[model samples]
Target: MPELPEVETVRRDLHRLLRGQWVKNVSVNKEKMVRGSTSLFKRNLRGLLVQGVKRRGKLLIFSMTDDKSLLVHMKMTGQMIYQSKQTLVGGGHGQPRVKRDELPNKYTHVVIVFGDGARLFFNDMRQFGYMRLVNAKQLEQVVKRFGVEPLSKAFTPDKLRRLVRGRKTSLKNVLLDQRGVAGLGNIYVDELCFLAGVRPMRRADKVTDREIVKLHKAAINVLKRAIAARGTTFNSYRDGLGGEGKFVRMLKVYGRSGKLCVRCKTILKRVKIGGRGTVYCPVCQK
Candidate 1:
């Protein structure tokens, strides 16, 4: 799954390359994954001019000229590749590396052609992603479901405390809950836990005030650094410019299960919490 860093990188790149470009045509090969009526989706998209691109949680919001926005969720295995006459860029999570010759091969399900001759391709090997068009009013209603934007200034210590109050779920689970903290996923959650010296298995209600402050700072720092580096790319994930991220080299304990911890020399441990694989240093993290 492409988490906050990967999604934000895509949003930034797409905004730079796609703003003000008119959608000339729409083609959908896998109809089942599209959310709204196909005809309505195509009609709203065909001639609309893109005003801007923004992201909330993991969703991409493409603001259009007619007050309608295009919402795309690149679920697991989905990739959005953009190509113009002068440049080509994009990559996503879950699919194998996209070969230069193999693009638009079989996984390319949706293609949006622009008036400038540039094309945006939405590819998903698993067919679970979806694209939908919504009016501005409906878009507001949709965004209301998302919780606090973790990167925003509004996410203060009080905000963090309020969300964690009386919650029995593990701290990692609380972070993963979109209704509590939008844009956090398993990968960054693990990194945040390790950075804060908090155990992923620690219950939210049991977190101390000192630990809460550390957790909040850790999340913000990790996200900001990851965004700066573009994003973590293991196999399939890529930035909107089709480049890989440099954050994987900075990772501490996300995937190094048996590796020695950089802090305490203890073998990092792997545990499954909420069905997600979690890694941490036994000595460094509580």
Candidate 2:
């Protein structure tokens, strides 16, 4: 699943490539994954001019002309690839990597042809992704369900404290809840817990104020660094420009279950929190 940093990198890449470009055609091969009838979906998107691309949580919102918005969620194993006469730039899942010469292959479910002879392909091997067209009102309703944007100015330490106040759920659960923190997923949440020196299974309400400050700072720091590096790419993930994220090399806790802790020589441990594998330093993290 593409998290905040990964989604943000895609948003930036698509916004730069698709902005000011007019959609000349739309093709939908997998109708079941789209919102409406295949014909209607194609009609709604065919001639719309893209204003820009924006992201709320894990959703990609493509602002188009005529007050229309195209919302796409690349659930899991989804990739967005943009190809032009001169360039091929994109990022997402890499498994069965979309060959530039053999595009619109077996996995491409949606293809948007632009007026400039360029094309954007949405491919999902598992076919779990979806694309929907909405009016401004619907768009507003969709984005309203998300919680605070962690990269926004609104996510302060006090705000984070208020979110976890009186919550008996594990801190991991609280952070993973999109209603509490919009863009955090299992990977970043585990990393955030390790950075804050807190156990993932700790009750939210038991967190100290000082720990809240550390959590807030860790969230900001990790996100900024991840975005700067594009995102974490393991086997499937990649940046919008089709480059691997450098942050994976900088990771300290996530995916380092049996490794030595960077801060302490103690071996790290992995525990299941909310059914997700969470790794942390038992000696360094509470």
Candidate 3:
């Protein structure tokens, strides 16, 4: 699944390309890929002008005229590709890769046509992604379901401390909770913990105040760097321009289990937390 960085990358590209363009048509190849009535969904999108694209957590919000929006979630194996006569750009899980010539390929479950004949394809190899049509009120409710955006003004050292207070779960699990920290995933949790010199398995309440400050800083630093690098691509991730993220090379312990730690020369170890593989350096993190 594309995390905040990857999703935000896509949102940025799409917002730039799709904004001000009128929806020429809406096609739903797979009914299950859409959340509401297919006809209503198509009706709501047709002819609507895309006002902007916004993201909260991993959800992409396409704001359009008439108080309508498209809420898209590229769950695990989904990809959003935009194509015009002059450009082709997209990003998501890159599995079952799309052949440019054979676009609207078997994996493309949804396609949005713009007034200029450009098209946006929503492809999912595993059919786990979804698109929903929503009104302003519905959009607000959806946004409210997520926690603080790490990049937003609402997230700070004090806010981070409050969010983790009283949590008995491992720091990994606490960070992964979307209700607490909106955009963190397994990859980032491991990296941030390592950067903070803390163990992912440490209990949230067990973390010291000083450690909280470190964690808060590390979280922002890691996320900002990852976003700047376009995000980490491991097997199945691409950026908005159909490019792989360069951040993978900067990863410390996320996928480097059994490797030597850069800081302490200790061997990195991997463990299962909340069913997700987590890697850390025992010596450095201790």
Candidate 4:
């Protein structure tokens, strides 16, 4: 799954290539990938100019000139490819195609054609991604289920503490919960816990105030650094330009089980926490 940094990178690239572009046509190869009524989907988006692109959590928001916006979630194994007469950019997983034959193989689910002959392709090998159309103002209602954006100013330590207070769940599970902190996946959560010196299995309420401050900083810092490095490309994630992220090389703990800890010579350990594989240094994390 593409986490916050990966999603943010896609949002930035799509914003550059898609803003001001008018939608001439919209095609859905897979009906399940369209969230709303097909008639309404085509009617609302066709002929509308894309004003801007923004991201909330792991969702992509394509603001249109009309009151409606397009929301897309590229779940696991999903890819978005942009093709124009002069350039080709693909992001998500797999290799990019610069030629017609190079287009996404059997997994192409949705295609949006622009007036200038450019096209954006949404491909998911597993058919898990989806697109929806919603009134711009209703976007909040649609995404209201998610908690505060981890990178936003509103996600202070107090907010995090309030969310986790008295929770019996493991700290890793709390961080992975979209309702507790949006946009953190397993990899970043493990990395964040390692950096904060908190064990993934520690009860949320057991984390102290000072440790919460450190955890907050670690979360933000890990995400910011990952975004700067274009996010971690462990299995399938890539940027909008179809480039694999370089942050995987910087990982301190996530997939480094049994490897020597960077801070201490102790070997990192991997264990199951809340049914997810977790990695941390036993010597460094409490």
Candidate 5:
């Protein structure tokens, strides 16, 4: 699944290309890829102007001129490709570099036509992604579900401390909960813990005040770096331009379980916390 950075990358790229374009038509090859009534979904999107694109958590919100929005979640193995005469940008999970001609292939599920004849294709190999049309009032209710975005200014050391002050869960599990701090996934969580020198298995309540500050700083730093690198691409994570991100090569512990730790030269160990695979350097993180 595309986390915050990857999803934000797609949101920004889509905003650059699709914003201000009027919807010419809508087509759904697989109706299950859409949520709510299919007829209403098509009806709300056609002729609506795309004002902008926003992202909440891992979902993409398409603000429209008609007081409605298209909420899209690329669950897994999903790809969103925008095509035009001279430019092409595809974002989501699947393929490091997607070709323009290869689009609308077997995975193509939903296609949105623009006034300029450009089309945006939604492809999901696993068929788990879905798009829902929501009204202005409904959009408000949806946005409230997400917690504080770590990349936003609302997230700070004090705020981070307050969120997990009394939590008895492991640090990894606490960080994974979107209700407290949004946008953290397994990949970046491991990196953040490594950067802050905090063990993933430690309880949130047991983390020292200094460690909290470090974790706060580390979270922002890791996320900013990942976004700058266009997000980590391991199996299929891609940017809006169908370009693979460069952060995977910079990962320290996420997938380096049996590898040597960069800081202490000790072999990284992999363990399971909160049922998710976690990697850490035993000698470096305590």
Candidate 6:
């Protein structure tokens, strides 16, 4: 899964290549990938100019000039490739093929044609990703269930403290909860807790005020750094241009289980929390 940073990187790259482009046509190779009726999805998007691309949690928002938006969730193995007149940028799992050679691939699920002979292709082997059309006013309603954006100004230490208050879930589990704070997955959650020196097994309500402040800072800092490095490419994450993110090299403890801790010489330990793999330095985290 392409957590928040990877999703944000894709959003930035897609926004640059897609803005102002008019949607000449919309094609859904896999009908299940379309959220609503196929005809309604095409009718709403075709001929509408793309104004911008934004991201909420792990969802991509394609804002249009007609006050309608296309929300795309690239779950698990979803990839979006853009082929323009001059260049091609592919991101997600699997290698990207040219527009003409796209549909032959088993993973190709959706394609959107632009007026300038450019095409955006969505390929997902898992078929769990989705594309939906929503009115501009309803956009908030669609994403309201998600928690605060970690990168937004609204996510402060005080806010995090209040959110975690009375929660009995483990700190790692709390961070992974989308309803508590969005965009954090197992990778970043472990890294955040490690950086904040908070043990993953520690209950959220047991976290101190100072630890909450550190955890808040760690979350934003880790995400900012990951975004700068393009995001971690562990299993199947890539940027909009089919590029692997460099942050995996900078990872502290996510996948470095049994490796020597950077802060302390203790070996990092791996365990399961909330049914997800977790990594942390036993000596450094406590």
Q: How high is each candidate's TM-score?
A: 0.97, 0.97, 0.98, 0.95, 0.96, 0.95
- Give the local distance difference test score of model 1: 0.88
Q: Runs in model 6 with CA error above 4 Å?
A: 94-104, 235-237
Predicted model with the maximum lDDT: 3
Greater-lDDT candidate between 2 and 4: 2
Query: Model 3: what TM-score?
Result: 0.98
Determine the backbone clash count of candidate 2. Answer: 0
**TM-score for model 6?**
0.95
The local lDDT score (0 to 100) that residue 208 gets in candidate 1 is 90
Candidate 3 or 4, higher lDDT?
Answer: 3
- Global CA lDDT of candidate 4, please? 0.86
Q: Any runs in candidate 1 off by more than 4 Å, and if so which?
A: none
Better of 1 and 2 by lDDT: 2
Stretches of candidate 2 off by over 4 Å are: none
lDDT for position 286 in model 6 = 80
Off by over 4 Å in 5: 95-97, 235-237
The lDDT values for all models are 0.88, 0.89, 0.90, 0.86, 0.88, 0.85
Q: Where is model 3 poorest over a 10-residue stretch in terms of lDDT?
A: 93-102
lDDT of 4 by residue, 216-248 (tens): 999999999999998888554556676678999
- Candidate with the larger TM-score of 1 and 4: 1
Across 1-286, the per-residue lDDT of candidate 6 in tens digits comes to 8899888888999899989999998888899999989989998889999999998888899999878999988888788888776767766554333344444367777889998888888888888899999996789798898999999999999989988899898888788888879888888999999999999889889999999999999999999999999888864455666667899999999889999999988999998887898889999888
TM-score of 1: 0.97
